[model samples]
Target: VNCNCDYGCPCQFNARPTDGTCRAVVAWRIDSGHFGDTRLDGLHAVNIYAWPGAIHEGNGSMQSIIDERASDAQRTALVAILQGEGADPGAVMLQIYRTMCTAAHEPLYEPIHLDIDIAERTARLSIPGLVDSAVEPIRNPVTGAPHRARVDLPFGKEFRLAEVASGRTRATGVIPLELANT
Candidate 1:
C-alpha cells in the first residue's frame, strides 16, 4: 500500500493520527492466488485508499481503483477482497477503511505501475494523477545521515515488517498518499 501521510505516520509513534486523519492509497499485485476456487493470476491490482480522522473514527472516505485489463470475474474477485471481505479481522487497511470512510469514490480502471525491492527497502507505485508514490530511506538534514526504522507484525496482514522511511508524494485524487526513504 502506498500512503500519503506526514513523513513517518503517527501510527508508528503510537500517537494520535497523521494529517489529523489517515489518507492513503493501497494497491497490490497478485502474482498468484485464488478467490475461493476461481484462479486469480496474471497481475491483478487494486487501489484502496482513505482519509480517517482518527485510528478508530468512522467517517472518512475511500476509493478503489482496479486494473483495466482484468476481466469481469477477476474484477469482482479483487473488489470483494479489497472492500473488506475475505480478509482477517482487525486487519488495519480493510477494517479501518470500511468503518471510517464516509464517501466511496467510484472504482477506476487504469494501468497501474508497481515495483518493489523489499531487501533494499525500495518500492515504486504509480497510478497516474491518482497516485505517484515512492519510498526510500530517511536522511539527516544537517549531517546528511541515513536513518532507518522498521515495524514488524508477526501475524499481521500485508508485510511482516516494513522498513519505514521518508518519501515523496503527489496525488490528484480524493485519497492522499506520501512516500519517503526510511
Candidate 2:
C-alpha cells in the first residue's frame, strides 16, 4: 500500500484522502496459486495507478508489471486477472478499480524481487526500470523507538487485516507513481 496518502490513511475509514487525489503502487507476491493449468508460485506483480480526485470519483490511469519468470500462459492469465477479466465479477477490488480507470497500459515483463515480513511490517519490492518500494515499521517521533500498529477491518475492501507502517516508493512507468511516508 505504497500510496500518496498520509500515515494512517483516512480512506480506511471512509473518509477522503489526505490530499484529495489518489495514486499508488500496489503489489502482490504470490507464494502459491494456480491459473487454470499454469502454476503461479513465487511470482510477483505490480499495479501503478493515478486518479484525479477521490477514487470513487472515477477517472484514473493504470499500468502493470509482471514477473518475467512466468511462462506465456502464466503471463496471459495474470494479465487477464489484472484487467478484471479472469475472476468473478465484483469479487475483488481490481474489478471495480479497472472500471474506474480511464486507461490501462500494456503490461511489462521483468524480473521482480520481493521480501516480505508481515509481522515486522516490512517489505522490499522492486522491478527494475519500473519501481522500487519498501515498507518499515514506523518509529516513535519522540523516543525514536519502533512503533507498531495494525489495521483491522471486518469489511475492508483492500484487506481484512494489515500492518501499519511507513513506506517509500518511486515508479517509472506510463502512470508514474511517487510517494514517501506512505
What's the TM-score of every candidate structure? 0.80, 0.94
Clashing residue pairs, candidate 2?
A: none
What overall lDDT, based on C-alpha atoms, would model 1 receive against the true structure? Answer: 0.67
| Residue 102 accuracy (lDDT) in model 1 | 70
The whole-model lDDT of each prediction reads: 0.67, 0.86
**Tens-place lDDT digits, model 1, residues 1-182:** 54556554666656666557666656677778988876778664755555556646677777788877888887887777767777667765675567566777777778888887767766687887777777666677888776677777786444577777766656677665544431
Q: Which candidate is the best by TM-score?
A: 2
How many pairs of residues collide in each model?
20, 0
For model 1 the local lDDT of residue 76 reads 83
lDDT of 1 at 9: 60
Residue lDDT tens for model 2, 1-182: 78899887788899999899988888889989987888888898888888988788889888878989989999998887777886576788888788888888889999989899876778999888878999999999999988988889998887888778899998877877778888
lDDT winner among the candidates?
A: 2
